[model samples]
Target: MRIALIGQPNCGKSTLFNQVAGYKAETGNFTGTTVTFTESSVRVGGETIEVVDLPGTYTLAGTNPAEREASRYLLSEDVDLIINVLDASHVAQGLELTIELLAMKAPVIVAMNMMDEAARIGIKIDGPALQEKLGVPVMPLVASRGRGVKPLFLAALRMGKKKNPDTSNYLKIKENDRMARHRLAGELEREFVKRGDRRVSKRDRLDDFLLHPFWGYIGLIVILYTFFQIVYGLGVLIETPLLAFLETITSQAATYLGEGKLFTEIVIGALQGVIAGLGIVLPYLVPFLLGLGLLEDIGYMSRVAFLMDALMHRIGLHGKAIVPFILGYGCNVPAVMSTRTLDDPKERFVAAALATLVPCAAILSVVFGLVAFYLGPLIALILYLLNIFIIALVGRVLTAMIPEDTPGLILEIPPYRIPTPRTVVQKAWFRIKEFLVEAWPLLIAGSAILALANYFHAADFFNTLFRPITWTLGLPSATGVPLIFGIFRKELSLVMLGQALGSMSFDTVFTSVQMITFTVFVMFYIPCLATLGALRRELGTKDMFSITGLTVVIAMITALLARGVAMIFF
Candidate 1:
C-alpha cells in the first residue's frame, strides 16, 4: 500500500516523517516539475509500503506551486492512504487543512502531533471524541520524542487494508464547499477543543528577546558568530589530526612510486583529492551541518526569515525567499528545489538566481581551507559578506528588469524546542554521507583528469584561454585550472589548487592579495554542476544559462575589485 503524509506548514509533518522513515527518504519530483516530495519505504504487516511526505500546503485549491502539485497528485488517486498530521496545540487552524484533505474521499488517519505542547499550554483535547467526530482514527503524538509515532503508523496501516474507510459526515456533505468546510471545522474545534487560561511558556519567554526589533538583530549576530566558532573550531580540531594521519599514509605510498611515471602521478593526484575531501572538507562540513540542523530543529531558522524579510523586500525578494537562501548555505540543490514554495514565478527566478551565489558548505570548505588556512578567518568572513552584497545587488537589478507582484511575508514562527541529540546527529550524518556518496566519485575522477591535463600540457591551453581574464583579475594563469574544476565541485577547486601548486601550503604559490582575489572569485563564480542541474530544472534552459553567465561576470568584477583594494592595503 502507498501512503501519503500531508499537513499545513509547521504542523510537525516533516518531524513525524523523519521519525518514521529514518534517514532513508529521497527527494522525488512531483510530475516532472521543479516541485518535490520526500519518498521512502516502510515495512508494515509483513509487506513493504511506499510512503511519500507531500509538500505542506494549507489548502488544496491554492495556486501556489506546492499546492498545485499536491492537488494534482491527489487527483491522480495513486495514493492508497493519507496520513494527515495536525498541530495538536493549534487544531483549530490545522483542522482547516485536515478538513480539506478529508474531502479527497481517501482513507486518512489523523496524527495529532505535538500533544506535549498542547498539554503544556493547558489545551485538553479529547482524542476519542475527535476520532468519533472525524469518523477516522486520530492518534496523538509528540513526534520529536518518538512518542506515539509507531501507533500512528500502525493505525495508518490498518486503515490502508480496509476496502472503503468512512470519513466525517462534515467532509461527505461539504466536499466541494469551502465555506461549509470552514464552518464545519469551527464546529469540530468547539466540540473537541477545551482551552485553559492563557499562560506564558518557555518558548514564549525566549521569543520576547529573540523577536524584539532591536535586540533580535543583535541576538542574530551573536548566534551566527557563535555558530561560526563552533563549525570552524571543531573542524580545525578534527582536521589537524586527520590530515596528519592521512598525509603520513599517502606520503609513504608516494615514496614507493617515486619514479615519476604518468600513472604514478595520476594515482597520487587522485589520492590527494580524496585526502582533501575526507581530511579537509568533511571535517568542516559535519560540524557545520550539525549546527545548521540544530538551528532548524530549534526553530531559529524561521525567526531568521522573519527578521530578514524587511531586508529581502528592499532587494525585490520577500521573506519567503529567505528559506531557499538559507537552505542554499547547506546545499544549493535543495535550495533551488525549495524555490517551488514561492507563489510568484518572478520571485522564484530571482531567489533561485541569488541562491546559487550563496556560499554553500562546499564553498565554505574551500574558503576556510585556502583563505583562512593561509590568510585569516577575518578574510573568510569578509568574502562571505561580499557574497551577500553581490547577491543583493544582483537581485536588485533582476527585480527591476522582471518586476512582479510580491505578497507580504506570511509565515509561521514555530515554537522553539530542544532538539533530540540523536536526531541532530543522524540528520547531520545523513547530509555528510550524501555529500561523500555524490561528490567523491566526481572529485576522484576530476582529480585524475586534471592531473592528466597538467601532464599532457593541456594546462597551457587553458592558461592561454583564461590568461586575459585571469591576468585582469591579477590571478596567475595556473589559477585558471582550479576555477574550471570548481564547476564540478567548489571544494574540489581548492584540492586542485593544491595539486596545481604541488604543495598544500598555498602561500608559496600566491601572495595575500591573490589569495583574497581568488577566494572572492570562487565565492561568486558558477554554481557547482549539481546546483546547475537544479537551477535548470527550476528556471529552465534560458534562465539557467543567463544566471550562469551573470554570475561569471559578477565574479570577475568582484575579484578584480578585491584585488585592487588588497594591493592598496598590502
Candidate 2:
C-alpha cells in the first residue's frame, strides 16, 4: 500500500517524515513532470510500505507548483492512505485544508502535530471528539521530540488496510468552497477545541523584538556580525594547531622524499590537498554550518526574509530570494537548487544567478586564510561588503531586464523556539559532509595533475595562455593555474596556490594589490562544477551557460577595476 504525507507549510510534516523514515529518502519526480516529491519506505506492522512526503500546500486549489503537485498526486489515485499533518495550534486554519483533503476519496489519518505549542497557547484539543466528528483517526503528536510518531503511523497503517475506504462522508463540500469550508472548519474547531485563559505566548513575545522595523534590522546585523566573529575566531583557534600538526607531518615526508623527484612532487601534492581539505576548510565550515542550522531550526531565517522584503523589492525580487542568497554563503549548489521554491521563473533565474555570486564558505576560507591572515579582518570584511554591493547591483539589473509581475513575499513566520540539538547537528553534518565528499576527490586529483605539470615543465604553458587576463589584474602569470582549478572547487584555488607557489605564506609571493585582485577574481569567477551541475538541473542548460558566461565577464571586469583602483590609490 502507498501512503502519502500532506500538510500546510511549516506544519511539521517534514519533521514527522524524517522521524518516521530516518535519513533514507529520495526525491521522486512526478509523472512526466519536473515537479518532485520526497519518496521513502517505512516498515509498519512488519510490512514495508511506500511513503511519499508530498509538497506542503494549504489547499488543493492552490495554483503554486507545490500545491499543484500535491493536488495532482491526490487526484491520481496512487495514494492508498494519507497522513494529513496539521498544526495543532492553528486548528481552525488547518481544518480548512483538512476539509479539502477529506473530499479527496482517500483514507486519511490526521496527525495533529505541535501539540505542546498549542497547549502553551491555551488550546486543548479533544482528539477522540475530533476523530468522531471527522470520521477519521486523529493522533496528537509533537514531531520534533518524536512524540506519538510511531503510534501515529501505526494508526495510519491500520486505516490503510481497509478496502476502498470512504472519506466522502465529510461535510460533502466542494474543493472551491473556500469561505464555506473555512466557516465549517471554524465550527469544527469550536466543537473539538477548549480554550483556557489567554496568556502572552512566547512567539508573540519574541516577535515583538524580532519583527520590529528598527530593532529587527539591528538584531539581524548584530547576529550576522556575531556569526562571523564566532566562526572566524573558532577557525583561528582550531586552524593554527591543526595546520601546524599537518605541516609537521608534511615536512617530515618532504625530508624523507628529499626533494625534486617527480614522484616526490605527487606525494607532496596529495598531502597538501588532504591538509587543505581537512585542516583548513573543516574548521570554519563546521561552526558556520552549525550556526546556520541553528538559525534555521529556531525559525529566525523566515524572519530574515520578512525583514529583507523591502530591500529585496528594490532589486525587483521578493523576500523569498533571501533564502537562496543566504544559503549561497554556505554552498552555491544547494543555494541554486533552493531557487525552485520561488514561484516565478524569472525570479528563480535571477535568484540563482545572484546566489552563485555569493562568496560561499569555500571562498570564505580563502579570504580568512589569505586575506585576513595577511592583511586584517577589517579589510576582509570590506571585501564582503563590496561583494554584497555587487550582488545588489547585478540583481537590480537582472530584475529590470527580465521584468515580471512578481508576487510579493507570502512567507510563514514560524514561532521562535529552541533548536533541537539532534536536528541542528544532523543538518550541519549533512552540509559539511557534502563538502568533504564532493571537494576532496577533486582536490586530490587536481593537486596531482598540477603537481605533475610543474614536474614536467608544462606549468608555464597554462601561465602563458592566461597571461593576458592575469597581467591585466596585476597578478603573476603563475596564478593562472590556481584560478582555473578554482572552477573545479573554489577552495582548491587557495590550496593549489600554495602548492603552485611552493609556499603557504602568500605574503612572500604577492603584493597587497595582487592579493586583493586575485581574491576579487575568485570571488566572482565561474562557479565550481558542482554548482554548475545544480544550475543545469534547476535552471536549464541555456540559463546555466548564460550565468557562466556572465560571471566570467563580471569577474574579469571586477578584477581589472580593482587593480586599477589599487594602482591609483595605495
Candidate 3:
C-alpha cells in the first residue's frame, strides 16, 4: 500500500515521515529541505507500505512548483491514504491546505502535529471535536518527540482500508464565500480550542534582537561573517594535513612513473588533477556541509528566512529566497532547485539567476586558500562582502526591470530547537553521499578530460583563442583556459587556476587588482553543468540560452568595469 504525507511548511510532516519510516530524512523548520519529494518504506501488520513525503506547501492553487508538485501528486498518484499533517497551534493557517486535500475526495487522516508547542503556547486542541467538524479522523501528535505518532499511524491504516470519504462540502469556495468559511473556522476554533496561561516565549527573546530591523540585518552580517571565519579556520586546520598527505602520495606516484613521458602524464596530469581538486575541495565541503546540516536540523535557517523577509521583499524576491542563497553557498544546482517554493515565474527566474551569483563551495574554497595564504582574513571578509553586494545589486536591478507585481512573502518561522546528533549526522551523511555519488563521478571524469586537454595542449589552444577577450577584461591569457573549463564544472576553474598559476599564492604573479578581476570573472562566468541542466529543465532551452548568454555578457562587462576602475584609482 502507498501512503503520501502532505502538509504546509513547518507542520512536522517530515518529522512524522521519519518516525513512521524508521529512518532519517532531511527535516528542517524551513520550507526548502522538503522541496523535493522523498519516498521510504515501513512495515505495518506484516505488509510493507511505501510512504512519500511531498514538499511542504501553502495552497495547491498557486504557481509555486512545490505547491504544484504536491497538488499534482496527490490528485494523480493512486495512494491508499493521505496523511495530512497540520500544526495544532496554527490550525487556521494549516486548515486551508487540509481543506484543499479534503476536496480531492481521498481518504485523509489529519495528524494535528506539534501539540507540545501548541500547549506551550497555551493553545489547546480538542482533536475529537475537530475530527467531527471536519468529517475526518484527527490525531494530535508531537512528531519530533515521537508522541502520538503510533496512534496517528493506526488511524491512517484504518482510514486507508475504508473507501474514499465524501468531500463535496470541502470544495474551494468563491472569494466572496471565504468570509463564511472564515466564520466557520472561527466557530470551530471556539468549540475545540482551550486557552491556558502563557509562560515567557523563548522565540520572542531571540527575535527581539535577531529580528529587529536594524539589529537583525547587523546580526545576519555577523552570522555570515562568522560562518566564513569558521570555514577558513576549519579549512586551514584540516587542509594543511590533507594537502601534505596528497603531496606524499603524488611524490610516490612520480617515483613510480620514473620520468617516462607516459608515466609522467598519468602521474602529473590525471592523478594530480583528482588529488588537487577533490582533496582541496573535501576539507571545505566537510565542514560546510556539517555546519549547514546542523543549522537546518536545529531549525535555525527558518529564523534566518523570517528575519530576512523584509529585505528580500525589497529585492522582489520572497523571504524563502534565503534558502537558495544559503544553498548557493554550497552549490547553485540545489539553490536553483530550491526556488520551487516561490510561486511567481518572474520571481523564480530572478531568484535562480541571482542565486547563481552567490558564490558556491568552489568559490568559498578558493577564498579560503587565497585569503589565508596571501591576503589575510580582513581582505577575505571584504571579498565575501563583495559577493553579497553583487547579489543584492543584481536583485535590485532585476526587481526594477521585471513587472511590478511580485509575489509577497508568507513563510512559517519554525521554532528553534537543539538538533539531535543522530539527525545531524544522518543529514550530513546524506548530503555527502549525494555529493560523492552525483558529483564525484563528474569531478573524476572532468579531471581526466582536463588531463587529456593539457597533455594535447587543447587548453592552451583555447587560451590563445580567447586571449583578446581576456586582455579586454585585464586578466592574464591563461585565465581564459580556466574560465572555459568553468562551464563544465565550477571547481575546475579553481583547479585550472591553481595549475596555470602554478601556486595558490598569486600575489607575487598578479597585482591585487588583477587578482580581484580574475576572481570576479570566475565568479560571474558560466553556470556549472549541473545548474545548466536544471535551468534547461526549469526554464526551457530558449530562456536558458538567454540567461546563459546574458550571464556571460554581464560577467565580461563587469570584469572590464572593475579593471577600468582599478586602473584609474590604483
Each model's lDDT: 0.80, 0.83, 0.72
TM-score of every model versus the real structure: 0.85, 0.85, 0.82
Higher-scoring candidate on lDDT, 1 or 2 = 2
Evaluate candidate 2 by giving its C-alpha RMSD to the native, one decimal: 3.8
lDDT-superior candidate, 1 or 3: 1
lDDT of 3 by residue, 46-117 (tens): 667778888878777756667777887788878778888898988877776777677675777888888888
Show where candidate 1 strays beyond 4 Å: 25-27, 43-48, 164-170, 245-281, 323-343, 359-387, 421-441, 474-478, 485-519, 528-542, 562-570
Q: What is the lDDT of residue 36 in candidate 3?
A: 62
**Model 2 regions more than 4 Å off:** 25-36, 174-177, 194-199, 232-286, 368-378, 425-456, 492-495, 498-509
lDDT of 1 by residue, 394-510 (tens): 999999998777767887888887787766776676556545665556667766776677678787688788788888988878877778877765756787788767787888888
Better of 2 and 3 by lDDT: 2
Among all windows of ten consecutive residues in candidate 3, which has the lowest summed lDDT? 25-34
Scored against the true structure, residue 453 in model 1 reaches a CA lDDT of: 76
Q: What is the clash count for each candidate, in the order shown?
A: 0, 0, 0
Residue pairs whose backbone atoms clash in candidate 1: none
Q: Rank the candidates by TM-score, best first.
A: 2, 1, 3
* Candidate 2 local lDDT, 1-570, one digit each (tens): 899999998898877777767565666667655577777788988999888888889999998877887898898857899889999988988898988888877888889999998887788999998888888888999999999988987888888888978666555664448999989899998898987777677777788888898998999999887887887788779988998899899888988998888888999987877886675356776877788789888899889999999999887789878878877876686678668888888999999999999998789889988889988998799889989988889989888898788868888888887777766766666556555665566666766776687788787788888888888787877888888877865766788899778888899998888888899899999998768867877778899999999899989988888778767755
Candidate 2, residue 156: Cα displacement in angstroms equals 1.8
Q: How accurate is candidate 3 locally (lDDT)?
A: 0.72
Candidate 1: what lDDT?
0.80
